[model samples]
Target: MTAASRPVALITGATRGIGRAIASELARTHHVIIGGRSRAAVDAVVAELGDASAFVADLAELSSIADRAAMLPELDVLVHSAGLIGPHEPIAEVNVDDLLQVFTVNVAAVHELTRITLPGLRARSGSVITINSGSGFTSHPNSSVYSASKFALRAWSDALRDEERAHGVRVTSIHPGRVATDMQQELRAMEGGEYREDDYLTPAAVAQAVRLAVETPRGGNIDELQIRPQ
Candidate 1:
């Protein structure tokens, strides 16, 4: 099929892990735009994906998003996978800078991206999927900052779903537990424990959930999907 005829999907954080997996899955039939902060990393993933392009922009820098958004003529699927897991510390010990940084990327960026892409999404009745975390539902000790950001993300997705449903845009929030990614390694290291891949969900598993939501019937919307490791 010609590129113009194929649907376009933009996946942030496509440099590695779950984002990369989702990009790969969508590239089977869609024109994938691999979004990442690092040009080198984005280029490498695009090279490996064969039928994909690169979108290098820092989500924390809101100004850059508009510039990148202008380059997208039309978008059929938007997957928000870029996020930051800030320093794990007690609520009383949380630094204000860390909180701001985490929220900037996790919540603020997602909001802006969704806003900027709404028109394109509406034109095609596209799908908006945010890769949320299980922490969005429940918090744990020393996870306040990350959980707060995710909780805010979930709220945004919920509101967006309600507001955009009238315009034919489907918004979904996928909450996955303990994905086996570099971020998981960092979390385990912070707790002075071993990182066991066997105990965590694979990135491909989360990608499958994204594919399912994106490929749902035209009149159906999978608003929220929660995947936990058994």
Candidate 2:
């Protein structure tokens, strides 16, 4: 609660990629919590980010994520970095299961996590930051499912920002273009061709965006911020 004690920052999907980078950035300033669906990955991150603990919570399973948040240490910031970017599948032609799976993680899970963390967040006037996608704003044909899931995430985040303002809990969403991550690699594979990793944003840069959003004076809240690959 005071400057002497480090504020706690909980990050999901923090084994590798953006999640891992965010954990590193936050660790420099706050005590960190590394979390993900993979126990191995989370443990690895915990090792690298000392003074941090690990947890296994799959975002796709909303109840499991909610449970983790309920048991989290007093947190000053919660970063929702876990996500899904499946292969391109046309809307009407897309697999039903895939569509629901994306929403289950990217949308519903965030809401549940927030609800579970609400009390602590309100008490400390903490913040919730969600890792979003530019596709949430601009549409790409084959990306309908993924984009729609993120669009819903952005909407929920906006609503939460307004709703939690009275409680001093700020909600911020960072919409970034493709980042050079394993998720991006998986996405590229769907094209059945090699893709230029240099064309995408780096995980470190995206993590920097998050650090900036969280470290500023609590007086001003960035309801939404977008970062793109240049």
Worst 10 residues of 1 by lDDT: 1-10
lDDT of 1 by residue, 137-219 (tens): 99999999999999999999999999998999999999999999999999999888999899999999999999999989989
Candidate 2 structure quality by residue, lDDT tens digits, 1-230: 22226888889888889988999999998888888888888888888777788768888877787666666766789999988886497777888888889888888888888788788888888989999989879878788888898889989998999999999998889998889998888888886768788999999999999988998797899888999999
Off by over 4 Å in 2: 1-4
Can you give the TM-score per candidate against the true fold? 0.97, 0.94
Best by TM-score: 1
Q: After superposition, how far is residue 173 of candidate 2 from its true place, in Å?
A: 0.9
Error of 2 at 128 (Å): 0.6
lDDT of 1: 0.92
- lDDT, candidates in the order shown: 0.92, 0.86
- lDDT (C-alpha) at residue 225 in model 2: 90
